[model samples]
Target: MRAKLFILIFVCCAAALLFPSMPGTDSLKTVFRLTDEPNEVIVRGMSGSALTINISFGDEEVEQLIRELQAPYPLLLLDMEWAERYPEIVQLIKKRNIPTGLLGHAGMNYEQNLPLLNEQLEKYEDFFGTKPLWFRTSDEQFPYTLRNALWDIEVNALGSSVRWHTGEPPPVIEGEIISLPHHREQRITLTDFRKLTETRKNKSLEDVLFNMSIKTKKMPE
Candidate 1:
């Protein structure tokens, strides 16, 4: 009995030393929240530094310009309003197999349009044959109420900022959502965005998109 007890204690000690629990004893639930706070949380968890550029120009000329530049970038947050007007452009992007995110306007709150939003999201999933990795509300305003609706759907919210230069630094909220400043020329090519995943070997697919917005750039107006 004495020998058995000694062996048990040794085993326990070894286990504790090898695998310690996190500092906070609380269980971490991975629910997606559609708030700026959640966005901040996701950004904090991103390990490798990545870059993101917002292609906000609605003019086809500008898009053509972008394509002409053809810099190796991974993700593009296409303006939904613009894409709605020219859905064919979105289809073109899809054909490229480039990951694209839709950016909504300030008044497009998830709370006001929960049913529609849910339906649209479902349709998006169906249309893409794969769920979108990133979704943003109000390119200018942050939608705080959207959190409740999206928490269950596993879709994260992207934060908005008025001024790129004077925004708060990204915070560690959780690993599901992230917020970023809105700078016109802040740019990322499809190649750089993919490179981000290379550095974060342990992160899930959702986590990569959640944190993508954290790396924003300031462009000259």
Candidate 2:
């Protein structure tokens, strides 16, 4: 009886080692969850010597727009819906050779957002002559289905280290990605922002991502 019990225990242990229980559907679904925070890989790829500033632009006032465009080599996050109505501004951005990414709206479910996102993506490609590598939603949460679709195409859903609202001054911290969203009543200026971090190096989105060795669909000309 003791010999038989030992054999049974050995077989059970071997079976458990060889064939683990499958993960439940819920566990699998968690793999597709979207986050509004930078992943470890992104944080690790950042430069320890510089701060990366991301400025969100869309239908901003002329003075504010100019200030943002002139800020220290920021990654301009433009809204596609606004871009559709303002081609001249888009052309100006192209001429200036600023590094840019897409900014989107949230709140809709997957079904409603999918078509809108597709249209925006098409417009972006048409405007920039290359596929975008990054996207950010106005709201923190992005729909899981759209996130999955973006992942399939290798587009990174970016999250910032600090999000600068209008009234407050843009803070400077090395090795951080600061997102400056638009507010019509924004009071800060380029001079004010520069005064804080003028000593540190400034880099574009592409600059940091290149450090990670990510391959895009095509390099934007």
Candidate 3:
């Protein structure tokens, strides 16, 4: 059975703070200073959903995943350091045209400082030729300061609207980006290499994502 899902889209609000300007972001501070809050609105809606999975890359089964998850089930997130160490992975990713994003900082709340955020952005942008279209903090967090920094760089990310991997709590429509949360009774995830090597699944993960995108589009906002 496909579960019902909600997509939450919200805004980023910037406020008064003294932040150090970074080399590539001289205009960022002034960009947010002009507005006390985001001019965007949050929209909530429901959808008939698919049994799709959105997996983040971990430090395992890199080659196997590359062989399997091309095109439809594209790679999503990888820690910046992993991307640096295995630069060849990026080449594979480019060939597949997979959309990948940077995982967040090592610890909590550094997005308040422009230079600190700049460092993270510079890492991926240098390689990918653009800032990330998606991002996630240590946890699936979206603190106000983090939102401000992400908004400055035109980054859009999705976070679990409720708990990290649970599928119960309704999404709270108050954050920087649109999050479409799907419910699957927890399995060993696609990122779980040990489990993938063990179990045999009937449906391909690619079909799940494709069906999901279609179903979600049909849902009225």
Best-fitting candidate, measured by lDDT? 2
Q: What would the per-residue lDDT of candidate 3 be over residues 152-202, giving only the tens digit for each residue?
A: 766643343223233332333322122221112232233443232223221
Worst 10 residues of 3 by lDDT: 5-14
The better candidate by lDDT, 2 or 3, is 2
TM-score head-to-head 2 vs 3, winner: 2
Q: After superposition, how far is residue 81 of candidate 2 from its true place, in Å?
A: 2.0
TM-score of 2: 0.61
lDDT of 1 by residue, 75-184 (tens): 45555445566667667776654555555545345547667566557656555555454555545333445544444566654433211222233332233222222334
- Badly placed stretches (over 4 Å) of model 1 are 1-41, 44-48, 54-57, 65-74, 140-144, 160-221
> What's each prediction's clash count?
16, 0, 0
- TM match of model 3 to true structure: 0.50
Candidates, ranked, lDDT: 2, 1, 3
**Model 1: per-residue Cα lDDT at residue 178:** 25
Q: What Cα-based lDDT does every candidate model obtain?
A: 0.43, 0.53, 0.42
**How many Å off is the CA of 62 in candidate 1?**
4.0
- Name model 2 segments beyond 4 Å from true: 1-45, 48-72, 107-112, 166-172, 183-188, 196-200, 209-221
Q: Where is model 3 more than 4 Å wrong at Cα? A: 1-60, 111-114, 161-221
